[model samples]
Target: MKRFLWILFLGVTFSSTAQRMVLKKGRVLDSIPVAHNATDNFGLYLPKNYDASQKWPVVFVCDMKGDGLNVLENYKTSAEKQGYIFISINNLTDTLSISKNVLIANRIIVGASAIFSINPSRVYVAGFEEGARFASILPVFIGNVDGVISCGSDIGSIEILDAKNPFHYIGIVGKGDFNYTNMLQTENVLNKLKFPNQLLTFEGGHDWPPAKKLEEALEIFSLSSMVKGNNPKDKSFIEASYNASWERINSLIYSLKMLEAEDLITQTESVYPRLVGLDSLKEKLRQLKKNKIYKTQKRDENAAFNKESLTRVDYAYYLEEDVNTYNFKNLGWWSYQMDELKKHSASPNAIESQMGERLMGFLNALIQENIGTLKKEDPIDEEGLRFLWMLKTITAPKEYSNYLKVISSSAKNDDFGTALFYTEELLKKGYTNKSELYDLKDTALLRITPEFNELVAQYLKGARYELPIE
Candidate 1:
């Protein structure tokens, strides 16, 4: 009876690790001076099927909300389903400090290796935002990540990565955000440095894992590890396989470069696809048979989804190929472009507090230049002035939507005269939104003409409904 009880307890304990995710149960090493107390800690996830005897590849994932362990859990299930070890850790430093990052990463890695049987040979790092930047540059500071996968943040370092130890990189970014520039630039530098890398861009704003990118990355992993099975292969067979793989890789590069060169086909004064003559590219690629293209090795659509780079109207023009007109152009991967943006990326002081300022600088000009003509003369100029003034009421970033509070209280009283001045300014500017006109409609109800209402309603839904004026 005693033996049976002990056996039951051991089985329960052993199988507890079989669940899809193992959470923040790993060892924590807090080397930071201030975090000396119990607060200095992190987490790791060992899958349910993880065995002490067999070694598995490692993938380090970092997230936003204080390590946000869920990302690890998600990646763990994904890795386990593919037979790999997943390491998730939290950064003690609130900001970007490389030395401390290395310490925390090494601690979890050492502990994971001892207990989880992690394969030291095949380690990968992945993260989002600050976490993404950390994982991307891990090879630079932390020493041993076979490859880096970045989801959302800027890598911040590509100049240091060259042919010597350039990491196999993969990035997924949103097309509508500033960081998409980073993804574009990383691809170029990786290609130039001869590092195997990919970037996928999606039509998103700010953040994404966006189903398609996961599929492509998984495909990259599988193709990258095709020869892992230890069958009865001898010296000659291994040599032949390696040679054949290089040939295939060379062919793919030749094709990818040719495709990238396609940008030369379309650079008009208008900077967009005219959707007409690109037949010249076929001849161009033929002439430069050295052109390289990516060839998908697997049939798995999930693994083939290349969302790291987006197909924007103005796809990047690699400068190495075009030396004359594009000297030191800020195009291509984020890491490379960030090198260009270093001065801009510097910590914001009052001088740089205006970085986020995208408001039209001409708003004040239009208000002051035409305020007289707005009230007494041309109806259109009067309309433009109203918009310019109302725009001034709003602050940078979070535009002032609460016009009720933004305008003077006195404006609410006398025929909303001040409000009328603001509304008319906007219309005269040649850009009309149904939303802004409708906002001032109740106060300046007399100015709400059908033409004005129609234009605003066309672009901004419920602009007319907000004030309920026809």
Candidate 2:
């Protein structure tokens, strides 16, 4: 692996400065100032048993919004249990470019390396959502990022990956997450590049995996370290992780999640081969594959995946067309598509139901991306913005903010009809904050109008203006 020159530079310049600073163990230490740049800070978690005598593996946890303490707290349990030093960047911002964020992350890493006894060969980065994407990109630029724990996201940029400099890529995502398919696809790409990678899926949606799942990820890192001779073999830890894998596999099988169970079994087989015997695991996998129920479940899952792929293509094409042309008429079509997704969610077949939930998540995510792009336009595409806000009202009715945006924008354009129509729609969806309605931006005329007040009164029963005996 190429050397991290940045670390060498910081080690020379900041080591003396860092020697004077004391950090608390067994608790999160927030706002530890970077030695070179005191204004920039990071959160750190030293294991309770941490000692300067031995180097420890470190995981740099990224948070785009820089809620360092919260992100550190979330991973502290596993880090503590696994004896890994955890650090969170406290100044990362999504508003900045990726390059800028990478610079910020580099500074944090430099600071941490200067202050802590971190094993350079076992350094890892981790995060969820956008932060996870950022973490995955770090190994491409910064040398010696041993692995990445990407939660609910895929690689930030696959084109930039160097095949010769592959790192262990461990992705944890939920079955119902929109990024689930993306992570699986990324795994295929990593395999083509011969990158060491694994994808761990759970039974939930687009959120951080539970602590147990994170512990499993850390365990994999530990096992990988032993395999590469970076860390001494710990017999007790290996046996415990092996036993946990079997218990999880059994639970998954008992729950009839055949595919998930099979995936876990495959992962266990790969991780434990060097440390323990795998004959039992291999035979178990062989028998599970031959089981009629497992075969049927696998077939149904593949069919659902095929169906979801086609549906996703349709959604992407139509959403692009709808957004580009400001196709207000197609709003009904989008509504109908959402209804179809709801029907799929209500299906008796578990795989089909999961496909429905995933599709809905994908559509919402796609729409959000379009919305973000339109928001960044120089002139602020009002027509496109209005169309998306209108669509949001249909797809996510409970999101009252989009309804207000639609009403405010329509009124700004002097389209009182559109404004009043959404006013009633918003009220019909249980919006009762009359003060917010009256105070909405660019809706002064619309809010006081008889039609708006009448609709508000009809739904919420306390409009500012009376309907005059109608």
Top-lDDT candidate index? 2
**What are the per-residue Cα lDDT tens digits for candidate 2 across 261-297?**
8999988986776899999888989988998889999
Q: How many backbone clashes does candidate 2 have?
A: 0
lDDT of 1 by residue, 1-470 (tens): 11110111112323433222223223222221112223223455555565566766777666545755666544554654555556566553446467776777776555555555666656787878777877777777766667777886566577667588766677877644446555667777777788776675554545657654554464454445443331222446334533443354346445553222332221110111122233443454455444322122221211312321222111233322222232222223423433323443242421121121101222222333444454565444422433333433431213343233223332444445554444434334443445444454344543354543443454444345334545
* Model 2 per-residue lDDT at 185: 99
List CA RMSD, all candidates.
Answer: 16.7, 4.9
Candidate 1: minimum summed lDDT over ten consecutive residues — where? 1-10
The reply for model 1, stretches above 4 Å from the true place, is 1-40, 64-67, 73-77, 227-470
The models' CA-based lDDT, in order, is 0.47, 0.87
Model 1 per-residue lDDT at 460: 47
Clash pairs, model 2 backbone: none
TM-score of 2: 0.91
Q: What is the lDDT of residue 357 in candidate 1?
A: 17
Estimate the TM-score of every prediction.
0.45, 0.91
